[model samples]
Target: MARLRVFLHSRLVLSGLLAVTLLAGYLVFRYFYEVAGDFPFSQEMLLVFIGAIATVLITALLLIQQTDLELRKEGQVLLLDRKAQIYNALIDHIGEIVEKGRLDPAALADLRVLNHKLAMVASAEVIDRFSDVLARLDTAGHDVLVDEAERREIMRAVAVLTYWMRRDLLGRIDTEDEEAVLAAIKANNADLE
Candidate 1:
């Protein structure tokens, strides 16, 4: 999958570059052949070339925008999967922490397995999101862990993640199941923290 993604992206970039190079060559030929001997600076050719370049630029921008949107959508899907796995792990951990939790020995083993899966997913998601957030923070020249304002900003980042999870997972869950998960999460306050 990763290789395929890279191949597709490289293909798009190669195509775009090829297109712009062709456009540039066309403009150079049209200018020299049509206007070089006849006129010093033909406004008509200039406008035409400008329009062509603008069109190519707009197309490239739109394609890049679409790629960015698709990537964001994929990231959201990955994050949702991670959150679900994490929530399950939290549930199992809570069961272990609680009295009369109803989970059998085999269930405990399953919970440990869930935690492993959760760790993999969560690590990937965190690495991606953290890279993004840190880039933003760095660009803004904001200290990541210094002032109260920065702390609030970080909290907002966390809230956004939770909101995404709520929309993707909790919203789709049946009412009772949703409530149960919320209850479990609430009971295990340390899980989210």
Candidate 2:
């Protein structure tokens, strides 16, 4: 299947097909001319030849354009799915830390790995925000203790970062939606500091 797709998309293949088509068209015209011997070529025959060429060209262009569009869409969906999985992993790590009220060594290591993956796929803004939060958490130390307030703050930051990452992955988020997400985050906890 893959090889067939490659062949279908190849410029060499297209050129070859076009050459065959033109050759076949010329052969048909030659056959008619021979059969008509001494009779001049009619305008109808010329029109038929022109029409066949136009049809072939138009069909080829449209097929190529459609195939390109479909391939691009598939690539985008795959990227979004990968980003979502990384975001979910980060969220799960945050949840674990919040529940335990302390960052375990294993959780810290997992968060670091997840953050690295996120960096690969996330937009600049998301990477900056997520990295900032992660840096702060790391500075606080692996066995760092967190009170209720601090834990909630950390959770809120992670939540907001996750939301932004998802919105960015899905495509543009309008100003209104951005404001709403910010408001929701603030409402959940005074601020996502």
Candidate 3:
């Protein structure tokens, strides 16, 4: 936001600023020439040298800005990749539970460890949803969801959790978007029930 207010963001302001700078430089040269006696051959060459130095400085600044932008983009891509891997690990864990037809003590411990990994990359909302899933399993008397109603409820919870995970990975979904998601989930969960 602060960057958006810079002189470069406004072409007219930048042009006017450069024009003023050039005019001031010319006036200074005229003053020095008149006060000293002769005009600038030696000094004119000096001015040209200074101008070349200024051009080099400007080029370096531009290169630095470009490099900064590229590095920031790369960092974002790397973070996105990390987040995707963690999310995939979560889904894979669920697949393991489904295949085994039970969530044992070791499986629960693995889930807690996964939650720790999730904390490093997941949105706060996702972390909360996952914790809720853990809490639900904690209360179940059996190793698996043995009742149809309990199974359907767990499935709904998982679906809602997945929805939040998708939104988290994709980035930037506000409350209105959230309301829409919840509505869709509600409609679908009703069918499950």
Candidate 4:
């Protein structure tokens, strides 16, 4: 898509330059051919020439506006992509912690980095959801070694955290993208099942 935008912008610029070049060439030809002295200072001819130049300028302006709109849309898509990638990484980390039923300081640090990125880019509701998840993780992480029941308790806590986060985050994505994120989350969760 970026390549397409670059190509389109270049084409418009070339077209505008070609139009201006043609207008200049015609004006030079007029000065030397038939309008050298017969009407070198004719106001009527000058007005017509200026009008033609104005038309070219208006066309160029329109092309630039089109390019600007395309670039803005491209930027929006890039931002969305960044947000999605960060969210996915966070979801993956949470799934790992849930399935393993344990987390070290290093793993917790990595998850925090992921959470920070999402907090910065996601909507307010999504940020709140992540905050809830972080709080739960902090609470469950106090005891690293325990029995099966305790491990299951930790798993339950992690599940609740990620479920709410995914729910809120899905609301912000488009329909098609929401499905993709959900499918990825499901795939990541299958390891636990």
TM-score of every model versus the real structure: 0.41, 0.72, 0.70, 0.56
Q: Write the per-residue lDDT of candidate 2 for residues 58-110, one digit (tens) a residue.
A: 68867876877788789899988998888778778777877787777887888
lDDT of each: 0.55, 0.74, 0.71, 0.67
Worst 10 residues of 2 by lDDT: 134-143
Candidate 3 lowest-lDDT run of ten:
3-12
TM-score of 3: 0.70
Number of the top TM-score candidate: 2
Query: What's the best-to-worst order under TM-score?
Result: 2, 3, 4, 1
Which candidate gets the maximum lDDT versus the true structure?
2
Instruction: Estimate the overall C-alpha local distance difference test score of candidate 2.
Output: 0.74
Task: Please write out the lDDT profile of model 3 over residues 19-91, one tens digit for every residue.
Answer: 6656666776667667755745856765785576557555655665676678679989999899899988986
Q: Distance from true position, residue 131, model 3, in Å?
A: 1.1
Task: lDDT winner between 2 and 4, please give it.
Answer: 2
Better of 3 and 4 by lDDT: 3
- How well does candidate 3 score on lDDT at residue 38? 72
Clash number by candidate, in order: 0, 0, 0, 0
Q: Give candidate 3 regions above 4 Å deviation.
A: 1-40, 141-147, 185-193
lDDT of 4 by residue, 1-193 (tens): 8867776777677677767766876676566556456655564666577677667767766777787788888988887778778877886887677667777887889987887788778777667666766666666677853345554544455454455566654456577876676566555655564
Clashing pairs for predicted structure model 3, backbone only = none
Error of 3 at 24 (Å): 14
Pairs with steric clashes in candidate 4: none
